[model samples]
Target: MRNLLMKVSYDGTDYNGFQTQPGGHTIQDYLEEAIRRLSGEQLKITASGRTDAGVHARAQVFNFYTASPIPVERWCMALNTWLPEDIVVSDAMEVPMEFHSRHAAKRKTYRFTINANQYPDLFNRRYQIHHHGKLDIAAMRQGLSHLIGTHDFTTFASRKSTKPSHVRTIFDAWIEKDTSTCRPGTRDQGIIHTFISGNGFLQHMVRIIMGTLIEVGEGKRQPDDMKVILEAQNRAAAGPTAMGKGLMLWEVDYDIASQEKHND
Candidate 1:
């Protein structure tokens, strides 16, 4: 058997989520079916992590052990032939059997996009959330700064999460104004892009953080209140969970120097 790693990107608008469920269409379901059809074997693939329903991904990594003789280089083309258009395998590589996608991931980056437009963009409505009024970007930045270090993130995680530990380290967090598609004097100003990279995330963590930051932007909470919320270690201290559609799994990082490639 050989271990193959693949990078996948998908628009999650129509699916239930990344993981498979009974009678529910999912990214994993389609991926597994495509693989079974291509290789004539049932294989379970391990993903770096799962994205909730309506959450898109740019570079989600997954690894699977297969006995098929398909060339690693052709895995992308071969899988694309069977997978849907919204889901694509961008690249593939043969890796040492010891490499597991989820456990080996070092960091994950997620981006939450908010269209601060009075009127929604017709073409990109499915991928972004629409919010009215001018957001205080400076205040949001200050609130976000408080999340840049290790802390118990219980305030930002979903109450349903059963994880034993809510402690996670955030390496970086920032927001950018994307005006590339904006036109001056138009009702649309720009989109607010929030990026957060961390060692690991709890269920709905990023979304909760975004919601809290948006509240700060709206002056509902003081920027310094982020520190108070973090210290509270209570879920009720955070704001509502932002819509999942606006969030995307931007990237997953693994240590490149530690990777060992399989001999072709």
Candidate 2:
């Protein structure tokens, strides 16, 4: 058997997330089905992580072992032929037998988009969270600063998680606004995009972070209080978890050896 790594991109609007569910459609279900049909082999695939419903991914990684002799490019084409339009295989290649997509991943970056404006644009509504209230950008930035570095993020994760450890090193966390458009259209309205890059993330961690930052921006919470919340280690102390629609798995970074193994 040969190990294959796939770089997948999906719009998570309709599915029940990345993982396979018994009765629900998912990005994984369709992906595995396509692989089965194309390779004529049953394979179990593993992803870097699970993304909740309505959350999109730009470059999610997964790996599977197959005995088929299909070319790497053919794997991409064959899978796309069976997969839905929202999910596409951007790249696929054989990897070293020891390479595991989840274990080999070095870091992940996520982007949460907020439509900080009075009106939402219809075209981009599905991908961003729309809020009309005036937000204090300075306070939001201050709140996010506290989240950088290593911390036990139990307060920010969902109760459904079963991970043994909540300690994660956030290499970077910051918020930025796109004010490029000087135009006065609804589409040109400024947006606050939160970028979080870390060694790993717990379930709902990013969403809760976004929610708490939003509260800080709205003057509902003090930026300095984030340290207290982090120390509390209780989910209730954190702000409401933001909707999953606005979160996107922006990128997955891996070692060069892993990349070469996949390409080979």
Candidate 3:
């Protein structure tokens, strides 16, 4: 069986989530259906991770094993023809059989956006959370800085997660103010973008952290509270979960050196 790695981008507003489950349509279900149609094989694709409902992805990665003779380069165009407009297969390549998507992922980066405007930006409303309250970006940056480094992130993870460990290493975290070049009336006063990159994330970890940072930006929590929350290791000590619409799987990083060695 030849293993193929593919990058997919999707607008997750209509789907339940990336994973297939009862009673809801999903990204995986559509991909599987398209695969079965093209190759007439009932095969499963393994994703780097799952995004929650309404959470979009720019470069989500996945891998699948297939015996079909279709060239790897054609996979992207082939799959895109079958997928909905909101979902697109961007790239594809053959990989070593042992290269599992989730296990081989080196890091993943997520971006959460907040529309800090009294009047929302009509064009980007679906992709960002509208927050009327004035946000202190400086304070938010301070709070986000504390998230860098290794820590037990139980306070930020969802209780629904079945993972045994909440200890993850955060490589980087930062905030940025978006300066929109849209038409005069279409753009909002400001857009706050929060980015976090980590070795791995727990369920709802990015959203929860974004929520806590928003609280800090609102002056509801001190910037130093981030350290306290991390030490607490209790979910109750953190802020509420942010809306999934504002979170997107921005990118996934892989160890190319390791994969190349294996291929060699």
Point to the candidate with the largest lDDT: 1
What does candidate 1's lDDT look like per residue over 79-125, in tens digits? 99999999999989878888889999999999999998777889998
lDDT of 1: 0.92
Angstrom error of the Cα, residue 37, model 1: value is: 0.3
- Shift of residue 213 alpha carbon in model 3, Å: 0.9
Candidate 2 per-residue lDDT, tens place, 1-264, comes to: 788899999999999999987867999998999988887877779999989999999999999988888887788988999999999999988778888888988999999999887777689888899988878989989989998999999999899989999999999988889876325755344788999999999999999999998999889999999888998999999999999999999999889575675767
Shift of residue 182 alpha carbon in model 2, Å: 6.3
Task: Record all residue pairs in model 2 with backbone atoms less than 3 Å apart, i.e. clashing.
Answer: none
| Candidate closest to the true structure, highest TM-score | 1
lDDT of each: 0.92, 0.90, 0.90
Candidate 2: where are CA atoms >4 Å away? 181-189, 258-264
Question: RMSD in angstroms, all models?
Answer: 1.8, 2.4, 2.0
Report how far residue 114 has shifted in candidate 3, in Å. Answer: 0.9
Stretches of candidate 3 exceeding 4 Å from the true structure: 181-189
Error of 2 at 5 (Å): 0.6
